[model samples]
Target chain A: MTRIGRVWRKSVDGRTAALYLLPSIILFSVFVFYPMFRTIYLSFFLTDQTGNAAIMVGFENFVYLLGSSEFQNSMKATGLFVLYTVPITIILALFFALLANEKLKGIGFFRTMYSSTMGISVAASSVIWLFMFNPSIGMFNRLLGVLNLPQIQWLLDPEWALLSVSISTIWMNIGFSFLILLGGLQNIDEHLYESSRIDGAGYFYRLRRITLPMLSPTLFFIITISLINAFQTFGQIDILTKGGPSQSTNLIVYSIYREAFINYQFGTASAQAVILFLIILIVTILQFKLGERKVHYQ
Target chain B: MKKLLTSSLFWVLILAFAVLTACTNSDSKEKNEPTKNDTSSETEGTKDDGAATGEKVSIEFWHAMSGTGQESIDAIVKGFNESQDKYEVKAEFQGSYEESLTKLRGVGGTKDAPAITQVFEVGTKYMIDSGYIEPMQKFIDEDNYDLSQLEENILNYYRVDGELYSMPFNSSTPVMIYNKDAFKEAGLDPEKAPETFAEVIDAAAKLKTDEMYGFSMLTYGWFFEQLVATQGGLYVNEDNGRSGDATESLFNGPEGLNVFRFLDTMNKAGTFGNFGTNWDDIRSAFATGKVAMYMDSSAGVAGAINNAPFEVGVAYIPHADEVQRNGVVIGGASLWMSKGIAEEEQEAAWEFMKYMTTPEVQAKWHLDTGYFAINPAAYDEQNVKDKWAEFPQFKVTVDQLQDTIPGLATQGALISVFPESRQQIVTALEELYQGKDPQEVLDKAAEGTNRAMEIANKTKQ
Candidate 1:
């Protein structure tokens, strides 16, 4: 009787666990998993005007994308974008975090100011940046004129467009990264610093020896998140450039949107999406495999 | 105690995930539930009211008009509702033309679709091929509506196979708008704007100043299409896809090459200002005197004249150096009735469309918004005449349209993949500005269009 009662209790616990998970399970299926599967499925077919899968084209879409110069340009742009935004954002955010971590008067004010950009939505900031990047009436050109420097067509020139977009993206991302890094900086044990000070070690020495190693876990997390965010950037590109100036700013995600929404070529768009998914997956897996070893979790 | 703590922490994490997903899901749920509830309750309420009095058929009209256009449309709808007691038309402002068309796709060919939708001129082929629309010809035939009263130039673009698929509403065409101050400063006659490519190039060279470029055109595909059409050039084979299915792009031919070379000449001479793709940016540049002259939509002429500190002159878009001008194709949107709606609902939509075409309403629309009046008699309206006298630049746009030669080229292309082809043209123009060889870039764009068309053709059911 006791064994039977224990068995019944275990089964009840299992049932209750599943019942508790039902909501999230349903949500995940609806929002994330279903769309993901649909994207993969749609990659194998061509869609008609209404975006309905009309004919099965096998892997022709993928083959075409691989051979197409436009898609190749998109891939290169996305790669360069990721490279341009991630490291700068991480490094800049770290510098700000370190500065704001010091125990001094008005540090809270500095901290708030550093993280202020996190509050502004992507679309709003992009519009503001768009005005600033305008050729004739923008502040940047006026400043250049004042300095007796030749004007740069910040968003219009193909040579400068991608770099300009990257600069704005870096500025937009620094706030969130700064806040997270600051949190991590605050969480570091005070005794380690105290002991270092007692040992007659300088600030740089302590930073190199204790602070960095202790902050490694947080740094790792932030890097991973920033990398993913940079890879998935779409809003600023859409607002500022619309992937123009000879397709110089046509990032893969923006290209996907143009293909899907603007052109209504859902099959090729899905193929692009699938490729993006694979790229992100491989990058994340590589990050885990290689980067995790260096992170020291306390 | 430790085990209990761990178990509690696990539960808390699970609860947090549930809450997060719920928050995201609830937004869409909340949006959907209210609309469903309102529709059901409104129908019931209307049904109950109908039982007591005579039934009023309420139909939805999805339009892509905003700002002044929206206000004018709403006024017209209100007047229509008051004019009659049997039908009520509800006009909903969907976003831009592209966005509204996207939303329409979800409810198209279904009972939930709006009774009427306003689709852009470029979407004509797509809408006809989609099988989601009831051709305006049907309603016109049933009611014996007078089509001859409408503007022939505007009607030419929408009439496919001698049948009108949609009712032409707000129509516009491209015109060259220049600053009279700049033209006079350059010793060029402001009153006599350049009429051909070579003359415009010469004028542009003279107009170039230290601060302002000589010429500019917004890097839009519509303007490119207008340039090609004005030279009596077909965009696609098979009579610009009017006679049959267009199998190849013809824009890479000599006519398109002339446009490219014309721009390339100015670009190489450092007389052309590339204002990117946005209309506002280019217009602002013109307003600020960054560029002396530029191509602008007929619809934008009023605003340009109103906003510019200098006197603005509007003229027909220039043609190739050697060719006679063929004038501009009609751009803008038209009203279409849905096929799947109830017969009475479609009838109400048709009645609303007819009401929209009346001279009084069209005159108001033309005056309130810069879009051309579809009913040509609207120009004879006292208010339009008064307004035209006040702003004579508006007269140039009207004259340009009336002077257009009716042909397959000016009728516009009839391919379902127009948006994609336009994108190709945009990219081609962008490449041209970047100093690429004109023929190479144009050919590349044509090839891209061909691929898109091939895929579209293959996938057609």
Candidate 2:
């Protein structure tokens, strides 16, 4: 009787565990897992009706996407954006985090101000940036003119368009990364820094040997988040430049939107999206692998 | 103690599961609800009052007109509401033309659907063929509504296969809008605008200064339509713009080459300014006086006049001298009635539609908005004639349309995928405008458009 009761209790526990886990498993299957698989399924076929998949095209979309100049330029733009934004955002966020974390007067207020950019919508920020970059009446050009420097077409010129977008993106995103870094900064062991100071380690020496190594995990987190955000840059381009003057600012995600919605090439757009997903997946895996060597958990 | 810890761990897991399940259920509901609404709206046609209890039948009318246009539409609706208490007509402004179409298509069921919608010419084919729109011919036949009072050409635009699907409220065609100040500054007569393409180019070159462009036209399929029509060539060989069984395209012919060559020349002559790759940008550039001579929809006149910081002179679009006369395609939205409404609601809709198209209402709409009155009788009315005296250029759009040669090209095709096809043509034009060989650009555009047409035609099949 005792053995039977124990067996019944074990089964009941198992049942409870399964019941508890069911919702999340179903949700993941519905939203993330299902869509990823559906996209892969869709990538193999072309659109027949508006959103329906017809006969299987079998890798034709991928081949065509690889050959298109638009896709090529989009990849290049996305690559440049990620390159420009990831390192700068991480470095600047760390600096801001360190500065705000210091025991100084009005430090909390300063910290709040530093992270305030997280509240501003990307659309509003892009509009403000457009005004600031306006050549004839913009503040940036006016300041340049006053300083007797050549005025740049920050949004107009193709060469500077991507750079301008990157600048706005960095400003918009720095807050999230700074907050992440600040959280990590607050978690650090203060005794380690105290011992370093007692041992006559200078600020730079301590920062280089202790602070950076200790903050590696946080930096890694920042890089991962920033890279993902960089690849998905759409709102700024959509609201501001619209991938112009002459497709100079056409990023991958924006091109995906244009292809799917504007051009109504759902099949090709899906293939582009799949390609974007694969690239991000590979880069994220590689980033994680690389991060393992540098990130210090202890 | 170990047992307590284990039990607490289990409780934590359960709590997380509860939160996750709640989120998952809520999100699924959110995603599925909108799609359901969309499907229902497409079928029901705003039957929120599904239970008819002999109460006054209220009908919804969604439109995109705002400001002066909005005020005029509101006045017409108010007058209709007051004219009879039998039906209550509620009019709502639903964003821009594009956004209105999207919203109308997105919602499906009684809570949000409008009984009548003002669909633009670009969306005419899509709405007409979507099986959701009620044929205006049916409404006319049922109610014995007379469409003969409407202008023939304007009425023809809303007709599909000799049957009307929509009624034109206000129609407009592209006309030359030149700056009188810039014209006088360039030592040319502001009253006499450019009459030929060559003259336009010359005037534009003469007017070219450090701050201004000579000429700028919004690059789209419509531009090609006007350009091809100007040179007496059809864009598609199909009847009524349907390209079914069509073997060849007319755009890559001589007319196309001439149009593109003209653009390439203007591009090289520094007569064309940095026109953005879209209609709004092109229009804004022209309106701001950055471009001396602008060509756009005559319907855009009111907005242009109200917003433009300088005097704008409207004139006939310059054509090739070889062509008989200036021909411009009509551009504006028309009221499309969708299917699935009750007889009473449909009658109410027709009443509102008829009221909108009446000479008096149309004249008020046109005069207030600068869009051409679609009713020929409106022009005969003393109000329109009197208003024309103050702004004589308003008559140019009508005069230009009076002599228009209607066919597949100039009549504007009602293809299901016309917008996609237009994009291809625009893309080719953009390539040409950027200095590609004219013939090469023409050939490329023709090829791309034909390929897209083949795909689009398949959808029709």
Candidate 3:
């Protein structure tokens, strides 16, 4: 009887625990999960002006999206954006993090400066970069002029618009990655470095053998975030370029914005958004799968 | 375990409190009412014994004006609120034209939108087609408001099939803005601005000096629209500027080619500062006096007149040698009344609408914003006349509109997919600016535009 009573109490405790998690689960379902499901569901249907009633159009939106040259160009641009931003942001963040992590004078100031950019919103940073990149009166061209080089259309030339946007993203995004790397660097044991030094290991050899392997987990984290962010790039394009210099600066989200808001193609835009979400999801999963093998918990 | 439980309980209580607060806030806050944050809300329930009133009628007006515009709108709303105690009108600034549209659209339900909203000229078709806007003629006829004083051209942009959907608030057309300092630097008299296409080209060539271009024009589709309109050409075949059909893309003609050729010529002559990506860039370039002359919206005058480092001279946009000067269509926003408001609120809205269109209000708006007075009588007002004379550049837009032809193309076509089509045109222009042949670019653009139009037509009811 006592055992049965204990079992009943345990069952009650389990229910209580579920009750504790119920609100968050409900919120997650309502806000995040439901919207995600709705996004996927709406992607397959043609919605009316009010977005309430929809006509069942199986795969037509996807087909149309696939056939669209604009969509194709946007996909290509997004791919290039990912390629440019990921390596550049990670490398630049690492460089700053390494420099800031050094046991030198004013290291705290350098650390603060490196991480300060994380506080600026992407929209605000884009506006600041727009001023900085103004072709006629920008600081960039003035510096170029001082070097006696010809002025270049940073955001106006289709060939350079993607790269230009990438640079702004780099400057705006590096701080967050830097913080992650700095955390990873701080986790490395000083004893290992001391032992390596006592055993006649040089700085470069120790770094390659110990630091990189130890930091792989953080690198993986940054890579995942950078890739996701690069794919979801919208603010810089919307604020700085507005997909201009002849549609060369357009990314996935900007095209989605144009489709849903400006063009009122809600269904098509939803389809595009779903496609992007899936791509990000697949890439992220792949990253975790690959990164899990390299991430030494110890 | 006790600490964990306490913290968990604390968070749960906090979340519950937040959710409850949000719910109450939303419920008390009237949804879809235009003047949600109106002054009437703050005034509380005060019974004025002027007319029959149980619960006081309050109407919401969402506009994109702050600063002077906000102050003026507030004064007008205050006047309406005080003049009669039966109804209270509230005016709220809802950020930019794009932002207002986005907000209105985001709150999709009928009960969540503002009673009245200010949409830009390009969005007239989109707003009307969305079936949210109530035709102004209904409010005018129902309430017996004076309608005869409204100008025809000003009203024409808001009409679809002879039915008015909105009232013109701040109407402006494109005109040439020149820096007098830059003009003098180029050894040209600032007073003698170029009046013809040939002269503009010649002046531009002569004005090209160290790091300065004689002329720069925004290469957006609006410029092409204005160019085509000025040359006595139509952008759309039927429905003029108000068509629901999307499969009828027609900007690949001689006139469209001419626009490209002209831009190409400018580019080759180093007359453009490579700032044709957007309107702000063009304005900022002209403001800095790096470009001697710029063809942009006259509404942009307020920004330049107040912010430009040098004095600005406004003039009519130069026309082709054969065609005479014709006015460009207005580029500013208009006010639309949304559905789902109470009869009392609608009446209050009409009263506010009439107040906005009155000569005194419109004239004040024009003088302050560099937009044209929608009421022709506003021009006759002594205050408006004084401002016009004080800044001679303000007269250029008014004078240009006096000779407007309102050709099928010049009327500014309103289609469901015009914004997309405009992008297509810009894409083509970009290609042309990159040295591609005008004919080829137009043809390709027309093809792409036709495809977009097909999609729009398929979706249209």
Candidate 4:
């Protein structure tokens, strides 16, 4: 009788567990999985003005997108954007996280300041950065003028527009990276550093040997997140550069947006989206494969 | 302990995956949600109050106009609602022009679609080709309404294949507005504005100084479209896509090249300022004395006069010194009647559109906003005449429209993918601004736009 009761209780608990997971699973399916699969399916057909897939032009969109100069440029821009934003954000965030982890008197205030940017939405930050990047009346140019430096056309000159947009993105991302790294820093056992200090390890030596190795898991997490965020960067690029001064800042996401909504060429847009997915997927898999060796999980 | 560790690790993996998917999903989600407001509210509003008031027809009118434009629209709607007790007109501000059109197309064949919609001029071909618009001419023909009462030049733009698809509402034209005080200071006549590109260059050279640029315009395709029209050039093939469907763009021709060269030369000469494509920035630059001359929609005249501390002068858009100056295409939007609504509601919408375009109503709109009156008769109205004397800048647009020839070129490109073409032109213009060869950039842009047109054409088919 006791054995039957145990089995019954286990069955009831399993039912409850399934019920608890239902909402998230449903949401993940509807909002995430459904749209993604739809994007891939719609890649095989041309969509009309109302975004309903109408024409069955199988593989034509993919062929067109792969051969197109515009899509090729967008891929290159997306790559450059990722390269520009990711490492800089990770390093600065690590530096700030280390500083904020200290038990100094004003450390709490500095930590708050470092993570404050997490509160600002991409729209708000992009608008703020846009004003700062304006060529004639912006703060950066005023400072340049004071130093007798020539004023740079931040958003207009094709060479500099992408870099200008990346500056804003890096600023927007630093806070999220800092908060994660800070959590990682605080979780490290205090005795690890104490043992390192007793072993005649200086600050640089300890950072290299202990802090980095101990923080590798968090560092790995941060790197992966930052890379994904960099690939998906859209709002700042949309507002600041508008993918131009000659499509110099036309990242993959922005290209997808322009194609899907602006031009309403959903087939081509979906094809491009599928390519973006493949690119990101391959990149992440490669990161896990190559980067897992260095990430010492404690 | 191992069980707990592994269980927690499994959940963490799920959480990480959820966050990753959610992050990417958020971008398209936020960008797309504004265009999908439930149309259920539209039908209920009619039944709730509309039926209670003795079976009154409640017609929804969706518009993109907001801020000052909304206020004007609200006034007109109120006027129409009060002017008759049989029909109740409900006006809603959907979003930007693009958003409103997207929403309209989304509900294209549905009863929830508004009885009347304000579509921008570029949306003309798309609206007609969608097969969801009840041609305004159908109503005019049914009622035996006199179409000749409308301004021929403004009416010319909305007419295609010998029938009007929509009613011309708020119309403006591209015009050059200069700081008259600055022009005088620079030893150029404030009264005599530059009528040709060469003259503008000459004037701009003198007006530019160490502290200020002489000219600045938003890097927009509308201005390029105007430049194309000023040379009496078609923007698309097949008679500017009026006689037959345009399969390709005509914007890569020598006329487009000349316009590019003119702007590029002005840019290189240090006389023209490049303000990236924000109207507010360009307007503020002119207002703050950073630039002496600017070209914008004629509707910008009111904003200039209100904001600028100096005198603002309005002039006709400049032509190439060599090319004969053909007049400009109309700017701004029009009112289109939806096909799926009730016949009573459709008739009511038609009545409201006609009322809105009358001399008194159009004049009121023209005075409140800087947009040109759709009816030329509005200019002769006593109130409009008085306001014209007070601010003579309003007369320039009227004269420009009056002088315009409603031929194929000046009738404007009526292709479905005009907005896409505009975007492509901006890209080419930016490339030109960055010192790329105009021929290369425009040719490439034209190729892309032609492809967009082909796709649009195929979709329509």
Candidate 5:
């Protein structure tokens, strides 16, 4: 380390290196640590209707959440949502990234086109999708009628609501995932591809052997990020289905929001949030442990 | 020189923060500060004199209203501010009714809360329990204000223990809106709107064709609440919590079952298209002639008139054949004054509230927005008289409200957990439409609502 960077060493200098780290340390403690501990504290209480931590119920909120059939349904729904959106996003983004990485005509335009959805906010995109998913006069139904296909009850029916929301989420997430993959793809050494081709490797053969292996680190990052985001799905579900058609789209975060803001049960909401956190934590840790073996650092 | 550079970098970081600490607590920041807190409950006003040396007290007035409704509110605030020199009421659009409450609750125990707020009817119990509100009765009694000019049925919804809690500002009742062109095409009497669910089903058969539907209403909880009341049934026990605090919900009764059955049968026959709680879509559908007869807030009457390609007809919210149509509960929202503000500010809010309900202001509100004026006297105003003559649809809500027998059921339930209860009912209604047994859904929903009410009641103690 530079002498100036380590100036705070007690035996060496009077200047403190801790000064530079103070802002981030303070911010992290205030924003992250405080809310985490506060949520744990709140879980032991029963919140009043105005969401005040009123009565100390001594883990009753947690107990209730553990037994709540509705909360269980939300967990199942969130799992389905993650399953539906994550792989689809990764695959499509990888495909688009591969396509955009080529030395084709006007490739920058295609790259811009692929990544353009990154500019759209969740609410705005959800509204656009809402128009497409409307039961009666939606674009999808109109297209179905024209093609002589059976019209789907996109948002109204319970069977299709989750899929409908997932379709929009996948579409929304593809841009971000594509950008990350593209960066990873660009960083790959050209000589490796050239050598593989010279070694009698076909396009598919080289892709499976080299491209996929090298893209693992980016894939790992995108997978975990999208997984966390999918678990936190709210805007699309709220805007499109409102967790409705018999709670088909009632993801955990939306449920937590309702418990906190709508039902004014801060304790229950906090309990639910803690449960969701633990779930995400365990899943993410498993991903990291598994991914550490698979991902190539260089 | 290296030491000087290192020390200078440290000083630069400190200077950057000094410049970055430039804060502007603009009115928007003041408006939004309450939203930062975990508590979504509002705290009352902290005084800041707008002008030095006895100038007009600039008190903020927050509302959930937007669109043309917001324009109307802006006009009202402007009128009030101009009419008096003592106070300048700065009206701010907080958000939707639900968001406004969340923001209000989030701003708990802070001085940033607006002096007066617009809260929906379902929030009555919660508002009272919060103790942030200064009851309208306090100011009314202190001034001996004449309350008789307001419609009793409309006023009853806002009253707690025979004392008014909030002033009904812009109120509405659920009314049946129909497409007259479709009705005429179906060979049904276009003017005679159906009064019972059976009659609606009968009308639907005739109205059904290759391109259009006869009925549709979203699985909106408010409609379910109204349907329960239209049958002279209370949603909760203990006289809808007017006579005493309600301990349980009563929506699983035979009346409730029949209402569900009626909706179910309509769904089964493909006569009633369930919109599934998107009122905006259903309203647009009616306007575009996709649906013929649908029940919507009386507030939609104006939108229907303006937007519908064909003629629009209105009637009281349909009832069951065996059930007596007592009345539909008021829907829209009311104005509430918060506690802990200065007396002059409180009085100013009262004056503004009174001004808002005055015959002229009420008439303007009714004409501009589809919401009915709470003041019965507003109907007598010449401008409203002209509006009634021009668009007879405007009187349907007022007449429906007047015909309503003033009972606890029609007055609406006074439950603090009504929002959650409403959400549960919406869930139940959606499940019912999805072909679940209506009785089972209602029972499950009722149990959930009852538990929520019990929790709420216990908390208050």
Candidate 6:
């Protein structure tokens, strides 16, 4: 009781600190926290045409989503999308980062080129990809025609839609990951590499032992961000396929948008959103618990 | 320390109050500013008009027209503003039909809503049930307006329970646009386009070649609904949802199955071009000769005629072999007035709508964009006749509309959940192209629509 009282007294003494945090608290409550709580509240009820909660069907929205084939398809698509995009994007970005980190002639140009895709907005890039994926006169099909090969329906076939979206997503994401990893690579101590070289360690051996461990913190951060980003992907899916070819590319975020905005079924949309939030929360928590041990802060 | 804590708490509360008040004050200002400007403009108009006593009511019109349609609308609005000094109609392009409707929901049933909004044909039921609209019949009755001057088939889609809910504007129907050059190259009659599903399939097989597929349709729900409607098929129960609330989807009947099977057979025969769900993709494919025949909006006929290297032929959308063609439901948007706005503003909206239906304006609209003039008398105008003489394909669309049988099927289905149901149909079409069973996919789509309708009914306040 004494300790608790002392803690309370200590907090009261830090009223100045509370004043400092008031602005952020107010902003967050208005923009983020309020909407998040409203979404949770709305998840349990059906909305009318005006989007007001009109019917109370507690947990029915969540129950319906669990049993819905479309929602299940969305989950599967999101999982496969994460699987397809994250690793390939990380490794490819890492490769580009390593190459650009070296001291070579016009290396500055190379770094800029590697990170150029980050300059393009997702909507613009997705539009460009949409044209390239066109079945008739697209670059891909024309190239295939030139090679006398059977053309692939890049965005049309049910089998290829998700993969096609993931391919564009990976391309769009690589630049940011590459830039960050390059910054981390540049921040590593030069003396450590010099000492390793003096020890007669080969380049690959040093890369495996020194560079990776040194880059682990950056890698961990990128991985967590990329995982969350893949789950929330909407623009590319909307522009490229629009969850078409039999809903193959209907990622969770796009499905939520369709339900809430297009269908005006806010209850189901909010339930799906809540499920997505929990999944991301669990994934992030697991990452911090299990993956953080491998991260080298120094 | 206690004094510091108390002072800090007071400061914190003051800051929070300031932020909250600022947000609310700005919101109210935004809502009030338009009406303030409108009132000032009205007083100015009264001073100008002198004895007329007409208060200048400026009403915003939200439309989804783009490209040439937007250009035409701007010209028409300019004409309306200049023709009358009493009402000033400001036309604003608000993205696509779906997007604009979504925006309307934010301000719907409130004074903040636009006085006039152009909602698509599928949104007819939704707008009527939305409680945001003032039915056009009320205005027609008050003004003793002649509603018979408008095209009955076009007005039929907007009339609910024998009362016109909205003023029909920029109406269109689906037409099968074909490449005449491709037809000749395939040794088929260039002028005689396929009229039935079986004939279309046969034509498609012959039209198939190394460079082009025989047939294609933009996998859109509107085209599917048109195809089903032409077979005299009810999209939902209860007289196509015109009599009472729809409880089930009737689109999975034999009529829908036939249409799906038609596409399925063509797809299996490698004659159907799958251009995904984009309108531009399929349109471009048709223009580039990648597909010989495809379903397109009647309004798109002019563009096809201009863009395609080959001669374009426009015909009625095909129907199943066993069923006589029952014509098409209207597919374009209509102008709706808001109920909550000031009476003078509603009066302005009505005046604008009346001006829109004038033969001169409708003629210009039809010539500028290929959408059918809501007032059929616009066809008698010299400019439309001159344009039609140069390009007769426009006449086919008009004839098709005039020939439509006035029945519940062609009047279009009434359901607030039309957009959701259309999405279900789109998915079913995509699956059918993926080699899924025709009946199975059709039934699945029906079930989806049924569930949506049920939920909509249950949640209706």
- Chain B TM-scores of the candidates: 0.91, 0.82, 0.85, 0.91, 0.88, 0.90
Per-residue C-alpha lDDT of model 6 across residues B362-383, encoded as one tens digit per residue = 9999988899999999999999
Q: Can you rank all candidates by lDDT, best first?
A: 6, 1, 4, 5, 3, 2
lDDT of 2: 0.74
lDDT of 4 at B131: 75
User: Which pairs clash in the backbone of model 4?
Assistant: none
| Candidate 6 chain A lDDT trough over 10 residues, lowest sum | A28-37
Comparing 1 and 3 by TM-score, which wins? 1
Listed per model in order, the count of residue pairs whose N, CA or C atoms clash below 3 Å is 0, 8, 9, 0, 9, 0
- TM-scores vs. true structure, each candidate: 0.93, 0.84, 0.89, 0.91, 0.91, 0.93
lDDT, candidates in the order shown? 0.88, 0.74, 0.76, 0.84, 0.82, 0.88
| Candidate 3's TM-score | 0.89
Write model 5 residue lDDT over B1-461, tens digit each, in one string. Answer: 63464345434433332222111111123443333331112122222423333445667778888888999998988898778667668787887787788777865435556789899888888788787888899889998999998878888888888899898987888888998888888888888998898999889878887667788877888988989898988898988987777998898998799899989988888887776678777876777677899988888888889998899998888899986789888877888888877777887888888888888888899888878877878888999999899999888888898899988788898888888998999999888888899999999999999888877777774
Off by over 4 Å in 4: A1-25, A198-200, B1-53, B381-383
lDDT of 4 by residue, A1-298 (tens): 6998889887997889989999988987776678778888999998876677888899999999889887889999999999999999999999999999999998889999999999999989999988888776788988998999988888888888888888888899999999999999999999999998898889999889889999988887788778877887878887888788778899988888788777888888888878877787787777766887787766
Candidate 4 has a TM-score of: 0.91
- lDDT value, residue A177 of candidate 1: 96
Q: Which ten residues in a row have the lowest lDDT in candidate 5 chain A?
A: A8-17
The candidates' DockQ values read: 0.46, 0.27, 0.29, 0.36, 0.32, 0.33
User: Pairs clashing in candidate 3?
Assistant: B32-B111, B32-B112, B32-B113, B34-B60, B34-B114, B34-B115, B35-B60, B241-B413, B241-B414
Residue B145, model 1, lDDT: 91
Local accuracy of candidate 3 as per-residue lDDT tens digits, A1-298: 6999889887997899999999989986675566667767888887765554357788998998999887898998999989989998899899888788789988999899999899998878899998888887789988999999998888888888889999999998998999999999999998989999999999899888888888886786677667766777777888888887767878888888877766666788889877876677677656655655776545
The segments of candidate 3 whose C-alpha lies over 4 angstroms from its true place after superposition are: A1-21, A52-55, B1-55, B66-68, B106-109, B180-192, B241-246, B309-311
Among all windows of ten consecutive residues in candidate 4 chain B, which has the lowest summed lDDT?
B25-34
For candidate 6, what is the TM-score? 0.93
Total clashing pairs in model 3: 9
